[model samples]
Target: MPTASGSRARGASDEEPLRPAFDGPLARRPAALVARLRQRAVPSHWSSWSGVVSFGCLLVLVVTGLLLALLYDPSGALVRYGGSYSLLRGVEMSRAFASTLHLSFDVSGGLLLRQAHHWAALVLPASLILQLATTFFTGAFRRPRQWSWVLLVGVLGLALVSGWSGYALPDDTLSGTGLRIVQGVTLGLPLVGTGLSWLLFGGELPGTVIPRLYVLHLAAPVLLVLLVVARARSALRHGPVQFPGPGRTEDDVVGFPAWPTAAVRAAGLLVSTVGLLVLMGATLVVSPVWRYGPSSPGHAFAGSQPDWYTAFLDGALRLVPPGWEVVWLGRTWTLAVLVPLAVIGTSSLVLASYPFLESRVTGDRRDHRLLDRPRDVPTRTALGVAGVTVYVVLWAAGSADLVATQFRVSFEGVIWTLRAALLVGPLVAGLVTRQVCATLRAADRDRVDHGVESGRILRSPDGGYEEPRDALGAAQRWTLTRAAAPAARPSPPGSGADARRG
Candidate 1:
């Protein structure tokens, strides 16, 4: 062999040298992680930020929630509040409510963190809704990404239930009233309703419900985190969906690397989200339990309203006409509650199975890497618009009482109008949205086939005036032409004879 230094130099030049395993104490792990991250494929900018923001918000929520949980009590035992608030200095209240007040008014930095937690909870659902709508309108839930959509819906449902349970944990008059309504609705089901109510409340109303709800609220987030991880992993495996453009293909991914570029972008977003949450927490007052007294069975809460997420159900309850209950064999069947419950349940079921339903209807089972323009899929886009219209109308109807009081209109009139809108609005929206989609599709076809009008008058050979036309670029042409083509249905396996005949 040559001299040791010469041999080492030759090896470094001729072949790749091995990376140092232990540069310093505990250095290998970080270096390896950085290398791995650098190779990770990430989606384009617009599609990546929603998930980053959602993750950041959820992290903040978890940290703040865990800290707050250490100071919370879910029991119904009596206690006296002697905190900073002068109004409730010596008032006797339930332990749950008293602890909530103490957390809000007594502990250092507790109030700010608690409010931030609440804001994060609200942001979580909003982010999920935006992400869901993006996926739905972009047709990203097809083929390899089916599980991603299912996981997202599951996470959203769990998040809503967790928020509802957290709301009930305060044990204030408002929350207590909401809990009572929940109990009543749970008990109003036909067959398994009574058993389900018993399972929830133990024996009857107010039977060890708070502790159970507390456990659920705590556990729900962990499950959501797991589901989110699964969703992300599936996306990584299947690769991100793309829009048709130049130098783009179904087999190749075109985007930024995950290490320095994407990671830095996510880090910036995390910092900004935390800063915004802090600013909001420091100023905004949410769920002021002090204003509402402790839970009292004898008192009735006037103007009782659920949170915005639960308002649709509240609106449904409000819009239902009274005296719709039927009593049979010592059991009561409340049509007002049961019918709404049925409608919501059916809607949720349809929503969860929508990807499969769409696939069967369209007979398109091919793996799609490019997204279809909304106008290309007119019927599906129209259905999405109609669904959103129905949801918004119902959400507005939930605030019927407030609307009536503010506008000096009859509450009955508002309810009746909302009921009619709830029925007619979706139908009209579907029709209008379908027409708009068709119009857009037609315009796209015209632009792709013939050039767009340039608004310049040109003299023809016969002395007639005509407008000049501008040709579309390659990328625009590709987007519209590819989308205009009908989806290719996948052939069944073992169809070689049929293929040959064709």
Candidate 2:
């Protein structure tokens, strides 16, 4: 044991030499990625329910849209020979349109897919509405998030336009009618109107217009998705809109950690997606399939409805003067059509840029804590509601013929009635909305200043249960100084003495 070799062997054994084993080729990349996801995706303060829903809806829209895209034809060539002709004159179901029919009739679940696409399209706007409404109610769009709000409004506009593009792609008589409306609107512009219309049609009116629209319709949503990505980046830049508080401290917030909650949200999204697929399956059973017949220029669909999203546009067209024409620069333009476009475009632009304007007007640069109670902000809410009413009335205008036929009134008579309604309805609705808001504001103040109606029916001769109103959301609880900051709290007299007494 004391010999050199013996000592060396003993030392080696005692030292616990390295073991031979396979450290081969980096133990799988999937495990590494999963580890990274676990580390990065799970964060302390990032989870949103509304955002998740919107995202899910958008995903559905994209998937269904792609399927539709495969079946849809984006051509302007259509034949219209119902009987006794070469059967090639009116709008024929283009490559895309024919494919759509094939998808509906030929494919196993084709019709189901169509319904899914439609439902997804519908859900897209709904999600946007809810998301916007939630943010508006929560005051999440107050400061840093204002730009994102603008982007969102733009997204809504683009989404609507994209939906229109999709609607037109079917190339049915109803969509053909809708295309003519678009043509009229574009051509009705003051300058380069005809040029724009031509470009839209890829040549002349109603010719390659369907194809042009189809291309744009496919392209627009892609741009919107990119915009969404950019807007999401803004959320990172400005920090997400958080719950209101006295300060940006951790204690005031109530949110789950990002990962698990996000996973939960994903589950909800999946369930919604599955539900949409189910609904689509049901709707394809007997959709407005016949309404979009092969193709015919001679026979007009009695009252062809555009996709539901475009009901408003249909309504607008129906209200416009049937024969009113504008003579401009040696060209007769339809003012009825032009006016609506002007109104829609201007209104959209105004709305898109409104948040910045409002902030500038009020000089509000700080984060807002309280939610905006619609009642407390009467004028603005009223104005918005009035605008919506105006839009709806115009949308109903598109169905003027249907109305005329239904009510046995002349088309001209219905049109004139619509014109009157457009002028008067918004004013009345605005006044009413404002008055209602004012009343609610008064009630809110009374309740906040005084205690709520509580206490039981004490039978104090009056025999009334004094059920009181509860405190409002934090924002609504304060007196609404609409065009100004709220009044500062009055300093207590002899504050030091009061403090000592306390």
Candidate 3:
């Protein structure tokens, strides 16, 4: 054996090994090299699963929308030959409604395509509203996301415009009737009615109006997208809002990975598509066409119902006192135009200012991880429902003619009843809802301090009563005993979180 000095000199391969460093056997590789790397990527939290479903539905809308555009003639074109004065005259004409008729019966899959487009137009708005309700109920609109909530409400307006416009594209008897209603409402504006009508149609009543609407129907959605993009940009500048959950920490939140969430969303989209297809097919029952045949001025479609989203407008139009016309600048103006725009628009604007205005109203700075039970914040939420009720009443009144005749009442009576309900019902409901919420909230507060209410009322021989238990419910018990305060507005803008937002 070599001496100690010699062994040190040998140095266990201070020299190179026989094999290259990377040439080690595959089995010698550590398994974690692959596994560990996979574990650490973007933790896959996919927020907005419902929004993803909505986007998927929008995808279908875009495809169907394009087809409708191709089929529709936006020229306000009309068919005329040999001085035939009839609306359907001229065996061959190049007008827009004529083209729609051609598409309805002529195009292969055209009818199916039309039905799909119509169904989607209906479904998207309905879905968006439902999703908003979910967000509202969950109190997902609170804190860091308050502006996002406002943008969401605005999105509903966009959807309403888009749905209404898109629905008008077909210009079928039903749609034509709806268009006539729009013309009537727009023309009903005070002072500038005729000029406004001319500006919109480039002519008088019913001439090329469908084409003009087509232009608007097309433009509105585009404008909506731009607006949504702007609002979303503003939201991103701030940040997305998070919900209260186990995964969330004092400073942050956690959720299932993206892969799982995306998979779930995709699956939901698939189901929606299938369901829509079935709906479109089932709706093949012949649509009644003559009800709203080509514009007949003043002869309102005998039975008219506006699309759900625009129902409120119809309701508003119905409610204004018959003599509600106002005189301004020596010209006659109607509440029909100013009222809907003022009430709906102003209300939306005010609500949109909630993030900022509320902060000013209340001074709260601490980050809130919990949601307020709507009852705890009764006034605002109740007002929200009341606002919606008012809208429903208006939409119901839009069909005053039908309702009056159907029930053997004067159209005027129908309008007044709905108008009364519009003003009173929601407020009453709001108060009742608020009281119920407060009562429930108090009960919940009791449970946290005490245990479940056992409802075992014990009576002594003296007939005095004592209860053994105090309880609430799962939903009630889960909320914080003291409701989180609403956000307050700040004096000026700053880097840190502030309630002030528009």
**Backbone collision count in every prediction?**
0, 22, 20
- Candidate 2: tens digits of C-alpha lDDT, residues 420-450: 9899999999999888877776765566667
Candidates in order have lDDT scores of 0.81, 0.63, 0.61
Candidate 1 vs 3: which has more lDDT? 1
lDDT of 2: 0.63
Measured by TM-score, the strongest candidate is 1
Among all windows of 10 consecutive residues in model 1, the one with the lowest summed lDDT is 493-502
What local lDDT does model 1 show for residue 175? 89
Backbone collision tally, model 1: 0
The C-alpha TM-scores of every prediction are 0.88, 0.75, 0.73
- Which candidate do you rate higher for lDDT, 1 or 2? 1
lDDT score for candidate 1 against the true structure:
0.81
Ranking by TM-score: 1, 2, 3
Error of 3 at 27 (Å): 28
RMSD of each predicted structure: 6.6, 9.7, 10.0
In model 2, which regions exceed 4 Å deviation?
1-48, 71-73, 76-93, 133-139, 240-252, 284-287, 325-333, 404-414, 459-502
Off-target runs (Cα >4 Å) in candidate 3 are: 1-49, 80-94, 136-139, 188-192, 227-250, 270-278, 281-300, 365-370, 453-502
**Clash list (residue pairs), candidate 1:** none
**lDDT accuracy of residue 187 in candidate 3:** 80
